[model samples]
Target: MTPRYSLSQIVLHWAVAVLVPIQYWTGGSIERTHHAVHMGLSPDPWDVIQHQIHNYAGIAIGALMVARLTLRIFDRGVLRISARGPVDRLAQAMHFAFYAAVIAQAAMGFVASYFWFGIGSFHVLGSRVILGLLALHIAAAAWHTFVWRDETVDRMIIPRRTSS
Candidate 1:
């Protein structure tokens, strides 16, 4: 039987998942708007809209990450599919990396926008790290689904109707 994530877990996971891409897709627009406003020029309306989405979505991701972590702490007996091996350790490390990268990236975005601090430079690196982490995560999921023939992905995708 495949273990399934809690419904709250699944919902929060997909919510943040959906918002992360919005941040990436609209990232450029925020930069353009920032520069345009700084240079005493009128920013494009579309850029402004995209920038707003980028900002709000970033906040949403940060909030969702926090909520996910909190829910994880309280989500005892939740179904986890791991082999208790080196792969499991690596997976844990990857998950930690994801949490740190995303939280820091969002924090730096807030600081860089609201303050004169020099942390803006690092946010770009954080974004690239996020991209790398995301790629690795997707690859692992694909491996689990196809190469490994594991039903691990099913846990998040499908909820078991019968209670464990």
Candidate 2:
């Protein structure tokens, strides 16, 4: 069988990885630095710009995730877990939770934007959820790589061929 993630999947995976950090950082920064109640000091215009970029990036990430999920469902290149071992089961559960969190965070971000900010939210509660899930996802990946010494994370990053 195939040796690695499809080019599209790999690209999407990395793209989301890069974008999510920016989304989280800017989101929190904007909320902290630009609160109307702040009596300390106003945020610079760049902070405002970063907030805008963060908002847009949220939408882009959400769209890309939806596309990734669609492709995973339709494409034959996506691999399945090889066994039902404990680690494998944990990986499967984490993967499912990651997808669900992504969807939920994206939806919430959109709604927060519309309700809280207006015209740009795009249902972004999912974005906040994504931030939390991302931390868990990364920790799980590290565990799989460093502690479990499994090929699961490696497979997603660089697939191994299966004997046919």
Candidate 3:
């Protein structure tokens, strides 16, 4: 049997998974408002609410990412997955890409808040690229479960029995 991810690993994974989509939605809401105002259209009054939510969620995600990084570094039980095989290499690459994209997006949002100097938005581009990678990641996981007959995704999922 494959060793399962630690409890902290599972929690952090799900936490970020939930927060990222919410981050994207809130960022889109703000971007839309920005565009509408730029185009001389009246902005929706509720946009202010969305912007506030985005701001708070961004800060929270940033903090959680920091914690996630720390935990990842210290974690010794992360799935080894057949040492240096092609799929393992691809998974490693995607993991690194995710970390970079997520950190860049969060940092850009933070800096943009204080330094709005007519700079173009990277949120849309960043989100699209990251989302594409995420889709690939999901497809790979499905392949492992269905085609490869490996319990890869199961490592990340919480087990029903603690002492199994």
Best by lDDT: 1
Per-model TM values vs. the true structure: 0.90, 0.74, 0.82
The candidate that achieves the highest TM-score relative to the unseen native structure: 1
User: Candidate 1 residues 1-164, lDDT tens each?
Assistant: 66677887788889989999998899899678979988999999999999888878888898888777777667675665365899988988898788888988888887876784478679878999999999999999999989999887888888656555
Kindly report which residue stretches of model 3 are placed more than 4 angstroms away from their true locations once superposed: 35-42, 77-82, 117-120, 159-164
* Lowest lDDT block of 10, candidate 1: 74-83
Q: How should the candidates be ordered by TM-score, best one leading?
A: 1, 3, 2
Ranking by lDDT: 1, 3, 2
> What's the lDDT for residue 8 in model 3?
71
User: With candidate 3 superimposed using the best TM-score fit, by how many Å does residue 24's alpha carbon deviate from the native?
Assistant: 2.7
| Candidate 1 global CA lDDT score | 0.83
TM-score of 2: 0.74
lDDT of 3: 0.74
Tens-digit lDDT track of model 3 for 62-107 = 7777776776676555544454788677787788788778777777
Cα miss at 90, model 2 (Å)?
2.4
Better of 2 and 3 by TM-score: 3
